[model samples]
Target: MSAPSVPPQSDGGQSGRPGRKPGPISDGVGPTHRAWLEPLRTRFLAGGLTISDLSERSGWAKSKISELLRGAGLYPRWEITHGLLQVLEIPTWPMRRLWMAAALEAHKKPDWIDGCIQKVALTTGPVEPPLEHQAFTDLNRDAYTAYARVFLEDQEAFEAVQETFDLLWLHWHEALASSDVVAFAWPVLRERVMDRAYHSEDGHPELTHAAFNTLALSHLTDDDARFRQIAESLALFRAISRLPAPQLDVMVLTHLLGLDHAAVADVLGTPIAAVHSTDRYARKSLTTVLGPQHDPGDAPA
Candidate 1:
């Protein structure tokens, strides 16, 4: 079935009410909130599962799930969000926050206050100025290493890696909309692609593309080992993408493009001490999300 229609913006005209808001809900916040919620709802429904099915998987009551979906009554607690996220197998905090924000907004209308909410929602967690730079570089390096491990395992697993790359690519675009770090990393990404292609002995463009396709398709595989690896890579990328601007710069320079700490410091006009600190903090933060074992030291330095 086609998805339900979302509210559309109205042309600047009175809709038979004096100074009333133009849409179904006059509150300025409704449209923004609904916009976010509807997409998530559609995604859930598209999974071809019912609320009861979700409840069973998430261990939430069917009624609660329905209420959350309907955007009616009390806001869902983090436990509910966490439970549903577990059932969905979603691993990224940015994705979780995105959904949570949508769910929260569902019950309210957009207003001046929402601006602050959006800012907080989009901002990365606090990082000390000293540790901002190296953290991102380590993150990218770690991500690539993880990606390589997964890609090398099997052609099928390679597809899952590619799928993650596509998600990262899309997410990178989104990050660019809010920050320049992505823009800076684009060429680095291009270089990495070329490097991989050049290093491959097959030299067949189609086969190379197939290899990437293999990684992208990895998300579909049921193999436990491959599934976990792909999930891990995606989660890392998600965390890096959500990093605030300074850390993002470090990530692009150090990880995506493979610059050294000194180079990153020079580029950012920051001290090496600060760079080291940033790297440490970024790594620690990422480890918390990506798991301690997936530390940067574990990846190709």
Candidate 2:
């Protein structure tokens, strides 16, 4: 019998079919695949989940998951890819786009690394701290109020506060990375970086010294009002972070640590008057800085 007839293929160049996968002349596949897969693997490992566990949750086969993780597979099908993301509980929008871009690049010869490579390429070195520290201090105070509100009550108002924080966080990081304070430098410098460090280490003598040094190096010079607000917020965060297990429980439960004035007073062996007064002051201060419109009485703490 005659051999089976084969369909003719088009070759743009003087070579094999144009549409066919290219040979060595085409981009090598290894690096292209690695670019996309490496970050996924890193993130998965960082999440502390096993591949098998991920497979069970995502409803993907072990081999396919492995292949995807290995960058052996470049196709970005939503079913499989999004399933993995759902299992991981990562926000899907940006991550999905990142993966899809990698997959498309991998399909071509001379494949390129993933989007992270481009991001890194665009990034310059570490950014210098902002010149006006007051801006950052103000931002920190705002962030603290927003964060505190979320901690206090699980209400729609708190949800709005959380969304605001999310935007601020992105803006802050961009400012830090780009050294561009005009945009969102205040929040990034004061709240996200400096204030947390100050409070967390303020109680620690060694760390406190280092924190001051960082403040100096970052050139964080601010006005007294802004500085005081940052200091107060840090104190609050520190108090919350260092509360004894019982008091913490009570504060969270009643306020966030739980317990109303009487309950907190009984637990701490303090008078209800003291508990109530302290709570009132804290709430008032928070509201005053966050927004005068916010009601201290309605707040959880």
Candidate 3:
């Protein structure tokens, strides 16, 4: 372990205050990250420590210390921030919360954050993730992955779910603070999946990619019949994707992911009634968009 940085002493070998404080944090530092940065700056100034002192004491480069103080350059990893906080005698618990909130705001992946924290060992001990977080991940990982797989390849879908869980873990406290954890966490998962979803020219997630892979097309042996099925399937996919988010989610969870209405309700943290209503709206809207079928039973399941 590194020796704690000592504040310069006064004329009588008493602790002396720094002559000047560090400059104001730039406006560019986001509010969440700035919240954490301010205390580090305040503690450093109060300790009468110089950049060189922090650098030497923490075993960090002088340039790194300067950037951290000035809020310049890329957002730093938790490992470096934690080390500096220790050297400055700041309580890690409070700053850890603030650091996490900032990290979430920075849009870092969970693995990236975890890898960074693991890089540096601290006497305070390794960071323990919240216990409920593990439970949450276990419960929802498969459902989220299944939903994501509708639009993404298997590995991409898995990665999207992984990122979502990581984000939820990072903001676990905030998620708990919200009216409903599902309400908060679902949007995070949805955003992660949609970010990697295929988008049409207007930037909406469109299912045009899934059109050719339908079971209906596989059953059609004639070239003309297959081509017609392809066209209708394309139209259906576009309609399904263009539905409002709630309706679209219900359709995907129920029809595409093979989850039941109760299961969809459970996953979305919504009432069964809401899921049923949304499903009705989605099917009705599809019917409206595609026009009434001569034989409703012939519609693709």
Candidate 4:
């Protein structure tokens, strides 16, 4: 069967304009949509490609393309989305995951999503992951999993790591060209972890839940001492979570995961000097909140 045709024009003329704004996306799939749409938009704009250009290249109507660009109308099928992605020169494999995630959020069943892929004849035969990509995953997966587990449960943390590797596999070429693979991959891992993290009112990841699981709390046996330690640890963990991203990352690697500054620099793909500076900033920030007596240096150990 042929691919689905464009449905009725839904965006009026608002979307086809040169000065484009993203249109409303379905609430359930909004995050996944932006994950796919934002990169696609950046490439589209960078190439100076028009809806007409995309229509001619991708064989979709300008109206449909506009709606897709603005994220208006129905959650689109993978077939059309894939076509536009090709025209925009976005990597398809990584995007396939994002589209599938959005489709699931939009309540599409796994079998139904698979059927859509089959209908479009888009399935490529199974292939092995690149050796270098596999090597990277093998080396970093455990440490990354440990890092993610600070905020996530085991299964969630494992899935977050798996998703990060899948993304690295998809963009392995671009990642290789980057200054450091860790530098390229770390943010992606963080994004996946944070997506599942419990956020506070101010939008930082909430560590209260994770704080109770810390080894420091687990070792204290006396009820009164445990209670006091819990109070202290909670305050420190909350402060650690609220630090700016760079500082927070350094703190987590250095204190919680037991990585030294040199190791953290390697893991973060940052210079040792920068990691040291960020770690110092994090300590000062924590001290400012919990008092000098409640130094995070004592807690995570």
Best by lDDT: 4
TM-score of 4: 0.80
Per-residue lDDT tens digits for candidate 2, residues 186-221, read 232222222123233345211222212222224445
Q: Which stretches of candidate 4 lie over 4 Å from their true place?
A: 1-30, 123-129
lDDT of each: 0.46, 0.41, 0.72, 0.75
- For 1-301, candidate 4 gives per-residue lDDT tens digits of 1111112222323354464544554454454555566556656665655678788889998888888877777878888888887666556776777778767766789998897777665444225568898888888888899889988889778767876776666567777877888888889888878877889999999888767877877778899999998888788888899898889888888888888899889888899999888988888888788778977776563
The candidate with the higher TM-score, 1 or 4, is 4
* Per-model TM values vs. the true structure: 0.27, 0.27, 0.62, 0.80
Candidate 3: stretches off by over 4 Å = 1-119, 122-128, 294-301
Candidate 3: tens digits of C-alpha lDDT, residues 1-301: 1111223223234365564455778778864565557657766876666787778778888887788888888788777798897777665654666676567677888787778767866565226557887888889888998888878888768766866665565456667877877767787788768866878887778776566765678788999999888888777778888888898888878876667899998899899999989988888898898887522224343
User: What TM-score would you give candidate 1 relative to the actual structure?
Assistant: 0.27
> Between prediction 2 and prediction 4, which has the larger lDDT?
4
The pairs that clash in candidate 4 are: none
Q: Which is the better candidate, 3 or 4, if ranked by lDDT?
A: 4
Ranking by lDDT: 4, 3, 1, 2
Off by over 4 Å in 1: 1-36, 99-301
Model 4 scores worst on lDDT over the 10 consecutive residues at: 1-10
Whichever of 1 and 2 has more lDDT, that candidate is 1
**Whole-model lDDT, candidate 2?**
0.41
